[model samples]
Target: MVGDYQTLKNIIEQSLLTALFQPIYDTEQAQLYGYEALIRGPSNSPLHSPIALFDSAVEHGLLSELELICRQVSIETFAKLGLQGKLFLNVSPMVFLQDDHPKGATLSFLEQYGVAPEKVVIELSERYVVNDPELLAQALLYYRELGFKVAIDDLGSGYAGLKLWSEILPDFVKVDRHFISNIDKDSVKREFVKSILALGANINSKVILEGIETEQEFYQLQELGASLGQGYLLGRPELLPVKILPSVLTTHQRKVKYGNYLDKLASSVFQHAVSFDSQTKTGAIVDYFTQHKHLHSLPIVRDQIPVGMALREEVLELFASPYGRALHEKKPIIDMLSSQPVVVEADTKLDEVAKLVTSVHDEQLLWHFIITEQGRYIGIGSVRDLLKQLTEQQLQQASYANPLTQLPGNVPIYQKIDDLLTKQQAFHFAYFDLNNFKPFNDVYGYAKGDSVIRVLADILQSYCTAEDFIGHIGGDDFIAIFVSDNWQQKADSICQHFDQAIRSYYTQEDLNQGGIVSPSRSGELQKYPILSVAVAVVEPDVERCRSHHDIAELASSAKKEAKKRCKELGKSAVYLCQRRGPDGL
Candidate 1:
């Protein structure tokens, strides 16, 4: 107690804080996403422990000051070391709750280091409970509005983290080491990981698994289809972090996005085109259009800014008319500019560009649109090209979609898994089979069973985020590739929802008795348990599972295990397998 006060005082007064960076690997993309800025006190000091340091700062009534200095050190070090990707800075919510919390200090620090606000992620940990969630949310929202990204750190470490995630909708969710440790040998831990992935997928948050230390744990997460990971296995925290992940983490698989893909946009179809400076003569613009013959309009640029568009036909007709050539040949083409043309950012997706193109009330302006990169004129695109691309995408999707559930069919499901495996990505592939489904079909007829299958499909689809892929693999069997970190919880949620929903299908008497009287395989009467989904989850390994076919076999074995568990429990059950493909890779 005697030494604590002097230590804290010296720590703040001497500016003894420093930062170490830990790389976060994006397994899906097989690239380094960024580094997390971990703050540390002097190595030999008792305050060296980050928790102890921050706790002491809070105890001594200097948390805000300590946090401000920490941010400055992290930003400065990150810049000085020439780090690539984002820099995640931890900030306690209580710091923001302070009356003089040094507003804009982080941004100012960022500016001083020449770090763009968008490249930094402000991480809020759930370890410290907030007295006011609304105020914390507002504070995080303010950072977001200021161009900095927000993340909920230490997710699953406490109950408040989930609630905080729902409120903030942060860009990333960092799972605690407790969940990632020994997950390979622990089925329950694996299930927890699946649940977290599932939740992250549904809410569109990138989940980073922290504290991964062993080869088994690393491979375990990769199998779970984890998107981002940070720990000793990937790369340990150091004063200087590596820009690229180790070769062991690198893969040669093709990047695949089936139903969830939206990379194509207005920029995809934008044509690099010639532009006329606003001061160019009208006659010269007409002459240039005649030389090209195919160009409909020429973008008018003034000082790298798109001001308007000069129509080829409008300019030509005026000059071609009687005495028209002599009347306007020498004047600037600014007069020939049509009403402000449809201008769109190059990266705007097809659907949005479609709306902007169609929403134009004027018929002339609808013909072409200007595409800009960072507000500077880059190229032009025609509505016809945008529509053509949109139509092709829709048709392609429809061709691969199943007729019954309207979900991706066997081709897409296979392709999705094949791509993931080929790219050396880790993803848990769950094969779903309806328990006692055949017997139920025998008793209730085929059509009712089809309805039951559709209901199951809806349940899976409801939980699927854009990152998750759900497909119909023929009839009672379906596949869902969990790209979320919280898939275990989601898998449990899936079982919960399916169990409750299936009860509605059974007649009251049979449901009361707990199942229908169905024909057995031996043609004898059998009292089967209530209808439920038996889900078998497996994280595919690139070395063992060469293709989706190998995954199918692994999942088949897992399904048998799940069926056994379901029989004992008399309800939906999930079985996660960590077996090598067939005999071994």
Candidate 2:
């Protein structure tokens, strides 16, 4: 603290902090969503990292002063550069929102640069503990009323931010980088993103993911319905960032690509239905149900908001007893409404709907759920419809799966690689071939050949994580497209494991010689080594590669090279191609 004190003091006193803009992309729309203003101290100073600089500010009781300078510098530079799209200004709630802090400073600063309040997003940083929810909320509401939008920065960074989110419900949610970094390879992170996206959808808050430094991360975020992304892959922080969208990364429009109905949104099965206002008389609803016997249940609304669903059976039973009509004829329909109804937004994914339907204790509500748009009832859907679509989707996917190993076959494998290419994701393509499989099959018989294939399948499956695609390309050939960077180590591990595992398939006599005898094409007996797997790994420069066809051709060449390398190495080995793209070198 002694050595760093004067440097931090000098930076604060001199107002040496400058702002750099990092582009936040609208992944779905293929447009520039906005720039998150990142702050930096003097490059030569030890406080160059914003974390250290701000932490030093807090230690020196200059947090409020430092934040003010950062805000002013960020807002003014954003306007001076004429950077279009929203300007996200990160604010420490503890320092900036304190009651005694300068109230008109933001407006005055924006006015100096001629930047509109509407174009600025007041981002609340979640690094500080928010002891006063009311004060923090009042500050956000103040910004909202001042013609500025608000965003919760670093959501999931801590429990405080989570509570702040529920209380504030800002226009944007920038999820913490912790979950976004390796989401493609981590199922837990993927689930976390799924839940956050679902939460944002229900509340109509746009979800933004930060720290998407890889194409795999971006594709994973988009596939999970993330609306905004920010990281070095999109753009690094610059004094003046490029205004145009990155052509290669943002070229493809987001498509609804799913292997099955599990990923489909709930709106796919939407049907128009009538809803009753809560004030409507019970007798009137009963009369309407009687006239329309086909309608089993209907949603109840209050002032254009769905309150609950009303079942026809419950309403009819309420009136069937003697004197029941006189007892409840004039009562408002809200009284007999189901205590809790299954309600979903129009854009909620079908897979999510299925989870809610299956977990529910209410038998009727489980099947019949209300679908709403912006909290107003639009239609109703039944479980029967959801199940039918799911069944059809499963059967379709099953048809494409290989009957032998139950792994996805050629069609799905091709589609997977093509989709990654279309999304501009760079990945490793590993082609696997059983080196002596046919000879082993010839000598050991077909059943043993099948077991050998299954053994290879099991080995491949072991390497399958959330980020890699493993597919059976038929016969003795298979493929693995790895999104993670550690595929090289995995490729080595696969070869080494296969080298040892294949020996188990050889009979004692064959194992003794470490070879099998089979007839050659000309009918001469030939000796073949025990079955060994050969892997060819290709890292295509995605910019030059167009489709999976190009990848398949490259992989084929790599496979041939791997076979050559296997003969030279006298064991199973991975051949990594030095050449990239369709035409090697």
Candidate 3:
């Protein structure tokens, strides 16, 4: 056998590598999407597989060199071939900050091959242990400034995987193959995928489901809000002659992406036309409005406050209508126009707009809807124009929506949790369980069980106010959100209502017996206690929540404590679990 040193050097140098292109489809469009550049060495070569090659390289102190070669080749070849769409290239964190990186040369090569900086995605692999998080973060920042869109590869693969995400803030997150491989066979894996996907959304990161080899996985990932797909099912990688894959857009997804685009524009609504003081004359308003053709209307503000609106039509109508004849004499534009056309929050849903557009009530005759935050008019978005944008966003959301409850589901729930934690908002999170739901479902048919769940959801909805958030955690599990002050009260109310509504689904005999009278999984008669619930509440630390994996471990621990307490007390109607944090807290 060859000696370790020589063998390692040879493996690194002679890693006969080939490329495999896994398609990353548009989350909303369902098109062939783009491709993630994956590398595989010769079947017999020591450096044949990424795992083997990288492991051996690390052991031999050649990891940096091996990673460098891979980068050079992937960039050089893809840029030369003028590949369309995006190129996802995996880079090790250790190699990302190499002192002598050939970035200048790579950029020059890309220019020569007609590939722009935006077209290339640098996916930092989840392989090496990061010794200095600050160093990694700085490197990522530098690369992003240089026009390289960053990604974290194999997210949720190890202890350090989630940590890297906080440090790097990747543009894309590639879900590990292990989680994607058999999601159809395991509920646990599906939850894991949902959590990871949600984490990605919270960070505003795109997600690419890796190692998806079956149609089932593809559809499942789509349903989980994963817009990009990178796996064998779409198409395997090929050298040279790049063949374009077929479109993957579904009817529903196409509509949704359009909506999201609108929402994005709405976020920057403040950048549009300026609002005129309510005192401004019609002549002054017309001058400002004409200066910017993009402006559909002029907001009427009084004392730095927007309370009314003046539109192009309203101005023209002022000139034509009987009311206009009187204004024609002498009056300010504020006097001629109506009060601010019914304003809506910038974050309002497109569906809400759809309904408002068709409303016949005192719908405030208006040219546009003014979007505001905290009672301040920030931007004005036309209902007609934003409709298209809402369609697109919905498509993407639909891709990740859970089929069971039609709610945003587990993926969205994870995303919301991550967002709340990251924002460092002081809030309480309650993990809800249906207490003996399985036995109830088992005793009654799935249909009746579903009805009970729907009822539970209805009750939760009744209690959820604008500040409150609720999510379905899938299969007898639920989640509730509230600010610090009213969190416990909301949770108590939910439990009280849930206990009542859930019991109503049971038969008189079952309720009287105070236990489940049903066959077990093995068809044996079993009498388990009446259904009960346990909740685990916690205030998360944004910086430490890290990835879905970390947050989940915290939630899981809380849940276990709840379960243990329930068993110990021999009670089940409702129990408050422990609150966990650092030792001092």
**lDDT for predicted candidate 3 compared with the true structure:** 0.66
Q: Which stretches of candidate 3 lie over 4 Å from their true place?
A: 1-16, 42-44, 96-105, 108-112, 240-585
lDDT of 1 at 531: 90
lDDT of 3 by residue, 1-585 (tens): 222567657655764567666667654544445667777766776656667767776677676777766766676677666666788877777765566655565566567666788888877765777777777778777778989898878877855668878777788888888998878778898888888878878888887888878877777776677777776666666676333332233323323422232235354333465788766667666656567766667777776557877777557656566675456635666677644376766666666765665562434453566777777867777665666666766666644453444445666667777787777776667777765677777778799988876666555554555466666767777777676587777666766666665667777887888777767789898887666667777666555555455556666767777666556654433344344343313
Tens digits of per-residue lDDT, candidate 1, 94-168, equal: 887788877888888888989999999999987777788889889999999999999988888765887888888
Q: Name the candidate, 2 or 3, with the larger TM-score value.
A: 2
lDDT of 1 at 289: 84
Candidate order (TM-score) = 1, 2, 3
Error of 3 at 424 (Å): 52
Query: Model 2, 1-585: lDDT tens per residue?
Result: 622777877887788888999998776656677898999999988888898888887787778888888998898788888888899999988874455678889999999899999999999887877677778888899999999999988988865766778888899998999999889999999999999999989988888889988878888887898878898888899997854445334223312222342356778888888888998999999999999988888889988788888888888999999998999889999987766787889888777888888888877676588888888788888889988877776666544666676667778888888898888898999999988788788888899899888777766655455467777778888888999999988888778878888888888998898798889889999998877888999998888888888998888888899998888887998988887897667
TM-score per candidate, chains pooled: 0.47, 0.45, 0.40
TM-score between model 1 and native: 0.47
Residue 382 of model 2: what lDDT? 84
User: Against the correct fold, how does model 2 do in TM-score?
Assistant: 0.45
**Model 1, C-alpha of 530: deviation from truth (Å):** 4.8
